[model samples]
Target: MEHRGFTALGGDCELFRIDLGGGTLAEGEAWVRQMHDRFTRFSESSELSQFNASAGDWVEVSAEMDALLRESLRAFDVSDGLVHAATLPALLAAGYTRDFSLGSTPTAMPPPPPRPLPELLSVRDGKARLAAGAAIDLGGIAKGWMADRLAERLGDNCLVNLCGDLFARGSGETGEGWPVGFGDRSVLLKDMAAATSGVTKRMWGPGLHHLIDPRTSRPAQTDLHEVSVLAATATDAEIYAKVALLKGSADAAKWLEGRAMGWSFV
Candidate 1:
């Protein structure tokens, strides 16, 4: 097995492949860096930043951007508005204006009320547009999307783990599956994906964190600190994990009854 590790998207990233050479690992690393440079919300010159700045006007987007925009819309529908991409303004108002690694100071201002994603964003004819006051931070959805893409590009048998959003493809060296760390134990995952979502990692104060509840447009006040989920794809896993966390312990289990292959909450 060949392995490569690097830091990107505000956290550690790693890629592993079976029956592949070092050059493939290097190429994967480069692609991850390129995606980070293009979509990172912390950089003003990034494509995502430029789109956020041009709210209310139609802006031409690359094919990659178009696909991601469409995925964001799909995420909204699948998660039932729980996994919103256009929660950047609410996140900023909650004092998550910078990358979590650098730390943040809480603000006293309240976030604006939530709005439906369909009402706030539209994509068509190689172009995309945001409503007058709407802005988006792709965040975990971008990571999950990138992981899935990287796995396909890496090889038939590979695992791409960008931060905690990961996709496992093909069989392992022994032909069982890729050994992945779940909540407290290692699980063999084959042709599946997993993602973890939480408020504990990024919290700055009593009520300040990055996981904004689209229902209230505030940092979610949930019983569980974190939740991990398994699904058919990294994108679906990401959406499931976030929705599970936001639903809190009381309702999370019932809501996730048949949605995930496996799940753990803490």
Candidate 2:
């Protein structure tokens, strides 16, 4: 039997769904919608936004958010704070706050003031908590996590593509790996998720891009066009790809060598 999945992820376009020749797509779609409903800030009642909007010493969140934040923290240290959601304000300060569809170029107005890092953001009691006034942007890893969730909800016979950050289970009918290309450019194909991070055309200005270095509080100074990694988990591939791109190829290669994670740089 075949199934369908669909939802809107709140970043670029609505993350609508399309299922082909599948049965029980509604169950899968409903589960996917549940995820979207729980996560989308536009919904006005998402747990994340509620927590961010709430007034308390520490607003707590669900287990999923806790787990993902913990994973992100590990990535932060492993990548030397190069792959962090906490850097979103830095990104916006560098003229990257606009919607993705507006294109990848910076606006004419001066960039916003630099945003300070959170005083405390930690997981406690199986809940993710943020300090009273620390805003976060999970755009870096949320999509991959959603893809993972959808893949888990569905059996291992399909592919999950959240705006081209894709994850697949099992082989295609042709017995060949699912073809994944980066940035809607290039002819390369692989079985794993491929995430492309650059100052995308939308965030380019004064030789600056959205991807910032949390340690230095500036755009990362890396001589890499893109970085791609292959791993058992799509979340891993996404996180690694972003971290590698920020780390640049040299440091990334060293980091991967330490972890023994399969990767490629272009």
| Model 1 lowest lDDT segment of ten | 105-114
Query: 48-142, model 1: which lDDT tens digit per residue?
Result: 99998999999999888888999999999989899999888888888888888777856756666658999999999899999987889998999
Give per-residue CA lDDT, model 2, range 149-185, as digits (tens).
6665555555666654556655644456554554434
Candidate closest to the true structure, highest lDDT? 1
Error of 1 at 193 (Å): 0.3
lDDT measured at residue 79 in model 1 versus the true structure, 0 to 100: 90
**Prediction 2 global C-alpha lDDT:** 0.59
Q: Give the TM-score of candidate 1.
A: 0.96
Each model's lDDT: 0.90, 0.59
TM-score of every prediction relative to native:
0.96, 0.73
